[model samples]
Each structure stands twice: as C-alpha cells, then as structure tokens.
Target: MSSISIAWIALPFFVGFVIYLLPKLDRYLALSTAFASVAFALWLFVVQSPINLQLIDHFGVTLILDPLAGYFILTNALVTAAVIIYCWHSGRTSFFYAQTIILHGSVNAAFSCSDFVSLYVALEVISIASFLLIAYPRTDRSIWVGLRYLFTSNIAMLFYLVGAVLVYQAHHSFSYVGLRGAPPEAIALIFLGLLVKGGIFVSGLWLPMTHSESEAPVSALLSGFVVKAGVFPLVRFALLLEEIDPIVRIFGVGTALLGVSYAVFEKDTKRLLAYSTVAQLGFIIGAPTVAGFYALTHGLVKAALFLTAGILPSRSFKELREKAIATPVWIALVVASLSISGFPLLAGFGAKVSTLENLMPWQVIPMNVAALGTAITYAKFVFLPRGGEAKVGTGFWAAIALLIGGLFIANIAYPEAYTIANIVKLLLTIALGWIAHLLIFQQAFVKLPRLLEGFEHLIGVMSLTLVVLFWMMMA
Candidate 1:
C-alpha cells in the first residue's frame, strides 16, 4: 500500500521524463499515463491506508489516505486526464507535456504528504512547473505573468520555510501530528504563506493577471488544479488550527466579498473567472470537508469553463455572446456557468449547500452574499446574446461531458446536500443574483479601480496581508 501510494506520486514524473525523450510520442504517452494515474488513484482509494514512513533520522514522510485526500486526488487526476485528452491535438510541444506531468505529480504529492517539509517540497515543485507552464508559449505577456507568479511564489515559499523552521524549533518535528500546541506565530506565518498560494484576497492578487494572460489550456490547469495546491494546505490548517477558526472565518468573509466585488465589475471572461476563484476560496477556508467538496466541484467546472472558453473566440463577455454560436459548445458553457452559480441539481449547488451547512449564522449571510455575487458574475455568460460560430471538436465535447457528469455524480453521492431547505436557499441566491446583475452589472459604466491589476500593487497588498495576519494571530 505504501509503495502504491508512492507510485501515485512518482508515476507522472517518470512518464513525463520519458515523454521528453520521445517527443514524437508525447501525445500518446501523456494520455496513456494520465489515464493510468487516474485508474491507480482510484484503486488506491479502495486499498490504501494512512501510513507514515521514516525517510531519515528525525524526519519522516506520511501518506494520508483519508476521504479528504482521496477525494482531492481522484478529482485532480480525473481533471488532468481530461485536460490531456483536450490537449492531445492542440499542437503543444514536448516540453509542455513534460511540465504538465510534473505539475500533476507535484500536486499529488502535496495532497498526500502529511509533513510540512514534504508539503513545502511539493509546493516548490508545483511552483516551478507552473511557472514554466505559464511561460510555455513564450509570449511577452505570458513571460511577464509567469515572472510575477514566480516572484510572489518565491516570497510565499520563503515564509513557508521560515514557518517550518520555527515549527521544527518548537516541536522538534515537521509532521502535522507533531505540531500540536506549537506557537501560534509559527502557524500564522505558515498559514499566511499558504494563503498567498491559496488564491485568497490580498496575497492572491497575482491570480487574475496570471490566469487571464496564460494560454487557454494552461489557464484551465492553473485555475482548476494548481491553485488548489495552496488550498489543500489551507484546508489542513483549518482542521488543525481549531482555535483560529474565528480568524479564518473573518478572512474568509473578507476574501469572498472582495473577490466577488471585483468579479462583478470585470468584463474579461477569463479574468472574471479568476476573481471568482478568489471568492470561492473564501467558502473553503472556514470549512474543511466543505473545502474539499467545493474545490472538487470548482476545479472540474472551472476547467471545463476555461476549455469551453478556448473553443469560443472571445475574451470579453459581449464578444463571447456575439461570437459563440455553436449549440453544443453553448450548452456546455451553460452547464458550467450554472454549475458555478450553484444552480439546484448541479455539483456547485451540492458543494455550496454543504459548505453553508457548516457555517455560523453570521458567516452564513456573507457566504450567501458571495453565492449571489457568483450568480451575478456568471449571469453575464449565461444570459448573453448568442450569434457567431466556431468549430467544436471531440476533445471539447469529451472534456465537457466528463466534467458535467462529475457534477451529477457528486450531487448523487452527497445526498445530504439535496435537502429542500438548501434547494430553497439556492433558488433565493440565484434569483437575487440575477436581479443584482441587472441593476449593477448590466450598467455600462460600472468598473473597479485597475490598481489591483498591477504587479507591484499586488506585492504591497500581500505584504500588508502578512502584517495583518501576524497581528491578528498575536491578538
């Protein structure tokens, strides 16, 4: 079982290196490897047990196979496989495939690793691979975006390393289980660092620029899977740092409101989705189990949406409406948009309901408001005019089918989320969102200050966030 778990982490890197050596077979190799990884992860779900392995003196690596990790790994692998299928004919180079596989392996390692050191290593690997992937196309914009990502990521990782050193000093171990009763300062630093990567507001100010500027498939992977690398650790922090729930809740609410507010005003389609990603993280930071569910639903649907956006020929909402006339693609877009908006009977609805089920009454209102904002944001995409046409292919349809199917399966699998009261809440949120959209978002002049769009401003905001987080932890 332990070896199998390790295999899950190792397989992708191995296959990726091999594909690099044989560029002609890159597509076939990547597809087969991705499918095999998904199958193996599923098998691990059945046979794997939580196990801790000692890699060296006073240092050990742990593989946790609990439902949370299992669910994340399974969903991540599935999305990766789907993306590989979509990219098979996209004329990507061998280096792209190699980086994609490395990204997958790094993320898998992060999800399964139980020690802070291992998680940090996994995060570093993911950061490097993501930087390369973002810059893979070698466009001037992509290179700049990737550089911003790299700079912010390095700062985050530095904080993570500092926190890890503090943890080791305090507890003599870097393991999650060993960190009990450790200093709050150390934990705060670590959490704040992870928040940078987690796509929370302030620290995650780099997200929209990077996500919006990257190539379509890279954007899909970034929004869908890579951001969750930071999020998974945050979920663990929420569970482990029980005393800090209030702080987490406060930050979560702030981030949710801030992200949705920006998203509501944004006109670029992918940028809007990127801001929505920030808002959605707010829902997850305060609730652990719900975090997993929300991440799964969001990752799958977001990937499909980005891919669908790629098939269509527009970056602005108005242009997308005027240009996207393919029926099958439009249907896929609707499903993805509705799912993100928490429409009843969809995966997003289940995740949203379940997340709300865990929130406090005060927290509930902000969450609901965020949900409504999400609806308002997506309303642009769903209710827009449709007239232009683009060629749809097998990859697009196959990827869309898998993602939408996952939503239905999630709804069925989590029956508790399907209650009448939750359904009513979802309806109210959607209705309010649509009305708000008409009143506010539909106005031509509504726009946010473009200050947050600048890389230097974002760095300042991230610094301020760290100071604030530290003060909050001390208080």
Candidate 2:
C-alpha cells in the first residue's frame, strides 16, 4: 500500500516528463494522466485505511494516508483534472501542461506527507511549479506577479524551515506525530509561515495581485487549489496545539471580515474572486472537517467562475452588462455565484451550515455576516445586464458541468447540513445581502483604501504579524 501511495506521488512527474518530450501528444497525455490520477486517489479513499510509510530512517522522510489527508488528495485531484481539461481547451502550450501535471503531483504529495521534511520538499515543488505556471504566458504583468509570489513564498518557507529545525532539535525527529509536545516558539514560527501560504489577511497580502494578474485558468488553479496547501497544514497545527485554538479563531474571524470588506468594493472581477478566496479560507480554518467540505465546494465553484471570466468579452461589471455573453457562460456564472453566496440547496450553503454548527454562538454571527457580505459582493454579477452574443466551446461547457455536478453531489452527500433552521438562515442571509447591495453598493460610488497594494508594505505587515504572534506565544 505504501508503495502504491509512493507511485501516486511519482506518476505525474514521470508522465509529465514523457509528455513534454512528445509535444504532439501533450494534450491527450495530460488529460489522461489527470483522470487516472483522480481515479487512483478515489480508489485509495475507498479501499485504504490510515497508514504511515517510513521511506527513510535517519532523515525521517515519511508519508501518511489518513482520512483527513485523503479528502484533500481527492479534492486536489478533482480540481487538477478540471484545470487540465481547461488548459487543453484553451490551447495552452506543452510547457503549461507539463507544469500543471507537476503541480498536481506536488499538491497530492503535500497532502499525504507525514513529516515536515517531506512536506517541505513538496511545498518547494509546488512553489517552483506554480511560479513557472503563473509566468507561463510571459506577459509583463504576469512575470512581475510571478516574481512577487516567488519572493514572498521563499521568505515564508525560510520561516518554516527554521521552525522545523527547532522542532527537530528539541524532539530529535521531524515527524508531525513526533512533535506532540514541541515548544510554543516552534509552533508559532511554523504557524506564521503556513499562514502566509493560507492567504490569511496580513501574511497573504501577495494573493490578490498574483491571483488577479495570472492567466484565467492559472488564476483558477491558484485560488481554488494552491492556496489550500498552506491552509491544510495550519488546520493540523491548530488541532495539535489546542491551547492556541482561541487565537486561531480570532485570527480567522478577522481574516474573514477583512477579505469580504475588500471584496465588496473591488470592481475587478478576478480580484473580487481572489479576495473572496481569502475570506472563505479564513472561515474554513476554524473547523477542519467543515473546512474540507468548504474547500471542495470553493475550489469547484471558484474555478468555474474564473473560467467563466475568461470567456467574457469584458471583465468590468458595467461593460459586461452592455455586452452579450453566451447563454452557457451566463448560466455557469449564475451557478457559481449562487454557490458562493450560500443559496439554499447549493454546495456553499451546505458547507457554511456544517461549519456554523461547530462554532460557538458569537463565532456563528461573524460567519453569517461574512456569508451575507459574500452574497452582497456577488450581487453585481447577478444584476449585470447582458448585451453582445458570444459562442462558448465544448471545453468551457464541460468544465462548467463538472463543477455544477460537484456542487449538487456535495449537498446530497452532506444531508446533515440541510436542517430547517439552517435553510431559513441561508435564505435570510441571501435576502439581507441582496438588500444591502441595492441600498448601499448600487446607490453609491465607494472605494476602500488599498493599504496593502505595495509589496514592501505587505512585507512590513507580515513582519509585524510575526512579531505579535511571537509575543503572544511567549507571554
């Protein structure tokens, strides 16, 4: 079983290299490999129990296939498969396909790895591949965005490495399970580093620019899948350090509010979605199982929204209203919007309800506020007037169909999320959001201050956050 798990990690890189050499078959090969990867992950979920594999004795290189890890693996695989199909349909280059496959492999490895060493290696793999993919289009804006992402990622990983070293020195092992009683300093450093990856408010200031500037499909992948790599580990740490749960929850609430506040005022479609990703992640970090479900729904719906943005003639809400979009494209956008807004019977509603069920009464109010804010932000899309006729291809429709199907499947699978009270809450939230949009956003021209727009400013903020966290942990 361990060998099989290792093979799953290796399969994409091996297949990618081969496909890169055979450029003529790149599209077919990439798609086939993606589907096969998803199939293998699902099979493992059904047949396998939790297992830890010690690949190296002295180095403590280990892999874990627990139920929690399995859920992430499956989600990553599904999103990767959809993105590959989008890449093929959009006529991306062979290099793009190769990088995508490599990213898929790295993400799966990150989710399954049992030790800090293996996880760190996987993180590096993902970072390098993502940088290349974000810069793949070679536009001036994209290259600059990619570089910003690379620098921030390297700095965060350095923090993680230092924390991992501290843990190894204290415990003589780098395995997550072995670091049970590690010092607060070590845990704080590790948490701060992962927070940068998770797209949390202060540390993840690099997210909006990077996600909004990348190519549409790449934006989808970054927002929907890549950001979660940082988040999953953070959730694990929170579970391990129960003493820190209160602080994590406070950060989560603040992050959620900050994300939605910025998203509401942002006019750029992709940037709005990017901020929403940050906000949803903030909510998810408070509860792991609910986070898993939320991640799945968010990945699918967010990808679909990004892909839909790509096909639109213009990204400006006012311009989009003036131009005609394809019927299928409009339909896709509507489904994605409702899902993100937590409309009853949709994926977002189910996940939000499940998450709220696990929270304290006060925590529930903020989450509900965030959900309402999300709906209000998305209302612009719903009311945008449609004008010029555009034709969408089979690939676009296929991606949309797959995402919507996933949403329905999520709702069906999580029936516990559909109680009468939750259903009423969902309706009220949407109603409030709609009213807010009309009474506030539509009636006034508003713009929030872009305080974190500069990279240097973001670095300062991240530094300040680390200092504060350290002080808290020490005190």
Local accuracy of candidate 2 as per-residue lDDT tens digits, 112-185: 77678888888888899999999997888888888888888888888888889998988888988555677777
Mind sharing the TM-score for model 1?
A: 0.95
Model 2 TM-score is 0.96
Residue-wise C-alpha lDDT for candidate 1, range 36-140, written one tens digit per residue: 766765675576564555566566676676567766776677788778788877888889888888888888889888789989999988889999999988888
Which pairs clash (backbone N, Cα, C closer than 3 Å) in model 1? Answer: none
**TM per prediction:** 0.95, 0.96
Q: Residue 411 deviation, candidate 2, in Å?
A: 2.0
Query: For model 2, what is the error of residue 416's alpha carbon versus the real structure, in angstroms, after optimal superposition?
Result: 1.7
User: All candidates' lDDT scores?
Assistant: 0.80, 0.80
User: What's model 1's lDDT at 450?
Assistant: 74
Residue 189's lDDT in candidate 2: 77
Please count the clashing residue pairs in each candidate, in the order shown.
0, 4
